[model samples]
Target: MLRHFAHPKRLTLVAVPLAVLVAVAVTPQVRGQQGAGAFESSDEVRAAIARAERASKRADRRAQSLERAAGQAEQEAEKIASQSAALAARIQETEAEIAVGKGQLQLIARQQRALDARLGERREPLIRLTGALQNFSRRPLVLSVFRPGSIRESMYLRAVLETTIPQVRGRTAALRAEIDKSRALRAEAEGVLRKLAEEEDRLSLRRTQLAAIETRKRLAARRRGGEADRQEERALAYAEQARDLDGLVDRIDAAGALRDELAELPGPILRPTRPSQARASGTTTRIPPSTSRTVRSPSGLRLPVDGRTLRGFGSVDSKGARSEGLLIRAGAGAQVVTPAPGRVAFSGPFRGYDRIVIIEHPNGWTSLITGLARSDVNVGDTLAEGAPLGVAPPDGGAIGFELRLGGRSANPLDHLSR
Candidate 1:
C-alpha cells in the first residue's frame, strides 16, 4: 500500500489538488494587496467619470438653451440675416449634443475595460482547477478501491475537494457579476453611438440651410450695385498700408468715425423768395437731430462664440506681446455671432489674419474678429444683436475677438452679460 501511494502517478494526483489549494489560499492575500492598489487607481477613474458626467450634463443644458434660441429666431425671421442666425444656433446645438455623446462613450469604454480586467484576474486559477477536477472526476470510485492504497487516497482527495470547492464557487459568482457589468457597458456604448449619429445628421442639415441663406444674401448684395464693393476696396487698401493688426484696426476705426461724421451732416436748405413775406409768415427752419447717437458704453455684451477662453485682454501671447483681445479655443466650424447690434464696417480677409469682420457699434464701440473660414456679411450690412457673423476655421482653430472703445482695448469679460 505504501509503495502504491509512492507511485509517481498517484503522487501527481495528490499534488495537483494540493497545488490548487495552495494557489487558492495564497492568491487572495496577493490579490488583496493588488486590490488595494486597484482601489487607488479606480479612485482616479471614478473622478474622471464624475468629471465626464458633469461635462455631459452641461452640454445637455447648453444644447437645450441653444435649441430654444434657434426656435425663437426662426419664428422672428423676416430677413436673410435672422434666418442665418437661427440656423447657426441649430448647428451649435447639434455640436453640443455631439459633445455629450462623446463623453458618454468615453465613460462607457473605461467601465468596460475595468470589468474585463477584473474578470481576467479572477479566471486564471479557476481555469487550472477546472482541468484538474475534470481529470479526477473521470476516474471511477470503484476502480480507485480496486487499486492498492487507492481507497485512502480517494478519501483524502474528497476531503480536500470539500474544503476548496466552496471558495471556487464564490469566485465564479463574482466573475459572473463582472461579465454582466461589461455587457451593460457595451449596450450603453451602442446607445450613445446611435445618438451621436443623429446629432451629426442634424448638424449637416443645419449647415446646408445656412449655406442657402448666405447664397440669397450674396445675390441681393450683387443687385444693390458697386457701392459695397468700393467700400471693401477702400478698406483693403487701408489694410495694405497698415503696419500691424492694431494699426489696421486703428485705420478702420478712423474710417468709421469719418463715415459717421458724413452721415450726421445736414442736407441743403432752401432760401425764401421774399424777405417781407418770410417775416410775415413767422415760420422758422428746424435742423434735424444728429443720427450718430452716442452712448456711455456698449451694453448687454456676450461671447461671440461658444468656447474656452485661452487668453484674456492684457495676457502675454506667444509673440511676447501683450494681448489686446480674447483668444478662444473653439471647435471646428463653430458659429460666430454679434455680441451687440452693429453695422459691418469691414468684412473680408486682411494681411495674415485670415477672413475678418469689423463691426462698428454705437458710442464708438468697435468689435474686431479674426480667424474665420468664411465671411457671410458684406460691408455696410446692419446686424442685430446675436446675428450670425460667420464660422470658425474648419480644422478647429483659435478665434481672436477684440473690443475697442475709443481705440482703446477693454477686457471683454468685464462687459459680458452676467
Candidate 2:
C-alpha cells in the first residue's frame, strides 16, 4: 500500500524539481517561442526543438507574405521605370522644339529691324511733304505743259506726297502686328517647354520612390522566406514529438501490464481496472435528472456577446471535435452572466480551465462556464439564466459556455432559448 501510494508522491517530488531544472536550462534557448508546452509529457527535457519548430513556422509565413509583396513592388517598379522613360523622351522632344523656336525668334528679330529702317525712311518723306504742302497751298500750279519750273516741280511733288507716305505708314503698321503675333507664339512655346520639364521632373521623382518601395518589398520577402522555412521545420518537429509521445505511452502501458502480479505479491493490493471498466465507473459520466436541472437546448443557439460570430459550432474542417461551446468576446469588464437556471456545482480553477462555474439543471444536463475573471457563485448556489455572475476583463479570452448531456459534449446553442 505504501509503495502504491508512495509512487505518485515520489514522482511528483522528482517531477517538480526536474521541471524547475529544465526551465532554468531551456530559458535562454526558448526565449522567443510563444505557444509550445513547457515540458514533455513523460519527463522534463530541454525541448528546445519545440522552440525551433515554432520559430520556423513563424518565419515561413512571414516569408510567404513578404514574397508576395515583393513581387507586386517589382511589377510597380517596372511600370514606373517605363513611365520615366516616356517622360524622358517627351523632355527631349521639348528641348528640340525649344531650339527651333529660338532660331525662328532670331530670324523674326532681324526682319523686325529691317522693317524699322524702312519706317524711318518713310518718316522723312512724310515730313518733307508736309512742308511742301504748306508752301503749295499758297500758290497754284500752271495748267500748260510748258510752264514755269517751280509750278511743274510742285505738281510732281503733290503726286508723290499722296501715294508714297500713305503706303509706308500702312506697311509699317502691318509689320508691327506681325511682330506682336510672333512674340506671343514664342512666349507660348517657352511656357509649354517649362511645363514639360516640370512633368519630367515629377516622373523622375516617382521613379526614385518606386525604387525605394521595391527595396523594402524585397527585404520583407527575404524575411518572410526565412520564416516559412522555419515553420515547415516546426510542423515536422511536432510530428516527431507526437510520435515520441505515442511510443512513451505504449511503453508505460506495457510496464504497467503486470498490475495483477504486483497486487498478488505486495502488502496492500490495489487491483487495476481495465480501460473500459474504469471509464464506465467514472463519476462524471452523467448526473441524473433528479440531481441536475441545467439541461442543453434542443437547437437554435444564440451568441452571448454582441459581436458577430466569428466561427460556427460544428466546422467539419476542424482537426478536433467541433467546439462544444460558444466563445463570446465581450468588451473589457463586461458582465458575465448565466445562460440558464441551475445550481452551481463546481466553481474555481480546473485543469486547462481558468475561473470556471458548472451549472446542473433540472434535466440532468450541465453547462460549463469558463474563462471568467471572477466566479461569484459557489458549489450548491443556484443561478437563473442571464443573472450576473462576474465581470469579464479584457484579454480574459472569450467566455466559453459548453453543454453536456450524460457527460457527453453537446452543442450549447441547441439548448439556449434566446
Candidate 3:
C-alpha cells in the first residue's frame, strides 16, 4: 500500500470547503431546535434535534437528486437541439435536391415539347410519301421501265426511306429517355417530402418534453419563494412585537404608579384564540387540550426551563437577599416558551434582570420570568401554552422564575406535571 500525501495549501483549501458544507448541513437542524423550552424533558429536545438533522440530510439528498435530474434534462435538451439542427440542415439539403430534380423535369418537358413539334411538322410530308409508295406498289415492275418519271420518282422515294428510318428510331429513343427522367424526378421529390415529415414529428416530441421540464422547474421555484416570504413575515412580526413590549415595560418602570393599576385587573380571563380552527360548515372549532397528569394542579403550570435547578423558592442569594423565585441554568440562546396559557402582563428590561416577562393566568396566578436576551411577546397579548415568550441568554447564564398566587409567592415545582 502507498501512503497518500498532499500539499499543505491544497489540503487547506479542500478542508475549508468541506467544513463549510458540514456547517451548512447542520444549520436547518439547529434552527428547528430554537424553542427548546417547548419540550417537557431534555431527552425530547435531544430527540427533536436528532430528527431535524436526519430530515435535513434527507432533504439534501433529495435536492441532489433533483439537481441530477435537472442536469440530465438539460443535457437531453442540448442533444435534441443538436439533432434538430442536423435534421433541419438535412431537410434543406433534400429540398435543394428536390428543386434540382424539378428543374431537370422542366428541361425534359421542354425537350419533349420540341420533339413533338418537329414530329407534327413532319406529319404532312409523311402522309404524301405514304400515297406515293402505295401507288408505286400497285404497278408492275415492267411498267415502271416504260414510265421514266415513275422510275425517277420511285428512286427518289427509296432514297428518302433509307435516311428517314434511322431518324425515326433516334427520335423515339429520345422521347422514352425523357419520360424515364421525369419518373425518377417525381420519385426523388416524394422521398424527400416523406423524410421531412418524419423529422418534423421528432422535433415536436422533443419540444413537448422540454416544455414539461421547464414547467416543473417554475413550480418548484414558486413554492420556495412563497416559503421564504412567509418566514420573513413571521420574523418581522416578532421583531415589531418585541420592540413594543420593551417600550411598554420601560414606561411602567419609570412611572412606579402602574403597580396599583395592574392589581385592579378584572377576574375573568379571555381564552386564547390560538390553536383554534374553523370548520368547513362555517363554524369555529377548537383543538383538544393536552392531557394533564396533576389533578390538583391549581396553576396548571409547566417547567419553563430544563437545566439544573440552582436555588428553590424563598432562598437566600449571595447578596443575602431572599429570592422570590427559582434560579435555573439553561442553554445559551435557548428559546423560552410560555409555561401556561395566559395574557402578557409585563415584558421589558428590569433593574437587575437583563430582560423580564410576566404572564397573568387564570385563578389569580401570575408568573414572572426574567434573565432573557430579548422577549418575543408584548404586554396585553394573549398566548397559548408552550408558545414562544423570549430568548434565553448565553455564557452560562441562569434564568429566574416566580409563580405568585394572589400576592404571595408559590413554589413553581409544586404545580408542575413532572
Candidate 4:
C-alpha cells in the first residue's frame, strides 16, 4: 500500500498532486467554519464584492434622486409660501373691501333714515298740495294753473310745478340706485373672501403632500444607509481575507527560497560492494555487484539515503505510462542524503519534491534527493560519498531517491549492492 502511493508512475504522480491540493483547500474550510464565521469561498467573496459595488451604485443614484426631489420640494414650498403670502394679502384686501362695503351700506342706511324723516315732516304740506293739484292738475302742486291770477303768473307757476315734480322723482330714483349699488358691492366682496378661503385650503393640501414627500425620502435614505453599512462590513471582511492571503504567499515564498538552496547540494553515494566484504561460494546472488549505477549508464551510482525500499523503481501505472521522479517514504523531517560526490545542481522545491536536492556528477550523471525532513546543504555546494547531508530518522524510513543520466531516469537498483 505504501509502495503504491510512493511510486512515481503516471497515475500515481498525477493523482497524488491533485489530492494534496484538494486536501489543503478543503481542510482549512472545515476547520475555519468551526471557529470563524462561515468561511466564504473565493467565488462567494467575489460575488459579495460585486454585490456591494452594485448596491453602492444604486444608492448613489437614489441619493441623487432624493436630493433632487428635496430640492424641488423646497422650491415648490417656496413658491407655495409666495402664493400663500399673496393669498393672505388678497384676503386682507378683501377684508378691507368688505369694510368699505359695510361703510357704504351704513351711509346708505343713514341717508334712507334722513330721507324718511324729511318726507314725514313734509307729509301735511304734501297732502294739501296733492289735494289742490288733484282738483286742477294731474301732478301734486300745479300752482299756476290753480291761481290763474295773470297770464304770465299762471305760465310761470305751471313751469315750476312741472319741474319740481320731475326733479323730486329723479332724486328718489337716484337714492334707490345708490343703495342697490352698495348692496351689490358688499355681495361681491363676500364672494372674493370665499374664493380666498378655498385657495388657502388648496395650499394646505399641497403642504401636506410636501410633508409626505419629505417623509418618504427620509425613509428611503435610512433604508439605503442600512444597506450601505452592511456592504461596508462585507468589504472589510474581504479586505481582511486579502491581507491573510498576502501573508500566506509570503511564507510560501520563504519556504521556496529555502528549498532552492537545498537543491544544489551533493547527495550520498551507493557503493555496489564493500571493499572488504566477499560473498560466499556456490550461492546465487540475485544481483552481481558490477552493474552500471548511473541513470543513463550501467554502472557508477549511489544510494540517496540509508533506508529500506519503501517503494521500488518502475512504472506501475495501468493506464498509459507517465514517468515521474521517485517518492521516498522517509519519516517526516528525516535528513535526506546525497547519492554521490557531485556538484549541487538544484536546491529547490519542485512540484513533486516538496524539499529536494539535485546533484551533478563528474560523469554525465545526476541524482535527485527528495523527501528531506530538513535540508542541510545549499545550491553550488560540493559533497562527497558518506557526507553528513542531514540528520536521519532514528527509526528508519525510505528516502525518496532517483538517479538520472544526462536528464533521463535510471533504475536505482542497478547501482546498489547485490
Which candidate has the highest lDDT of all? 1
Q: What lDDT tens digits, residue by residue, belong to model 1 across residues 1-418?
A: 5454344554444455455444433332112211223223555545544543453454345445545555566433344565566566567656656655655565555565666576567667766776776687668666876789988888788667666655655656566566556656666677777888888898898889888887887787788899988987887788789898888889988887777677767677566887566544467544433334554556657677766577888988688999988998666788787777798888888778999999888878899998888888888787765677888988768889999976889888878765
User: Tens digit of lDDT per residue, candidate 3, span 51-161?
Assistant: 434433433343344344445555554433333222222222232233333333333334434444554554454345445545544565456678769667656655555
Per-prediction TM-score:
0.73, 0.29, 0.32, 0.27
Query: Candidate 3, 235: how far from true, in Å?
Result: 24
Model 2, range 14-123, lDDT digits (tens) per residue? 33333333332232221112112323221221223233234334333433443444455556544433332232222223322333333333343444345445545544
Model 3 clash count equals 0
Better of 2 and 3 by lDDT: 3
State how far residue 358 of model 4 sits from its true place (Å).
0.5
Give the per-residue lDDT digits (tens) of candidate 4, residues 144-227: 446557446545655565556555454444444444554454465455446546645654554455445434433544565465
TM-score of 4: 0.27
- The C-alpha stretches of model 4 lying farther than 4 A from their native spots are 1-300, 317-326, 391-398
Q: What does candidate 3 score in Cα RMSD to the true structure?
A: 37.5
Q: Tell me which residue pairs clash in candidate 3.
A: none
Off by over 4 Å in 2: 1-305, 316-321
Model 4 global lDDT (CA atoms, 0 to 1) = 0.43
Q: Sorted on TM-score, highest at the top, how do the candidates line up? A: 1, 3, 2, 4
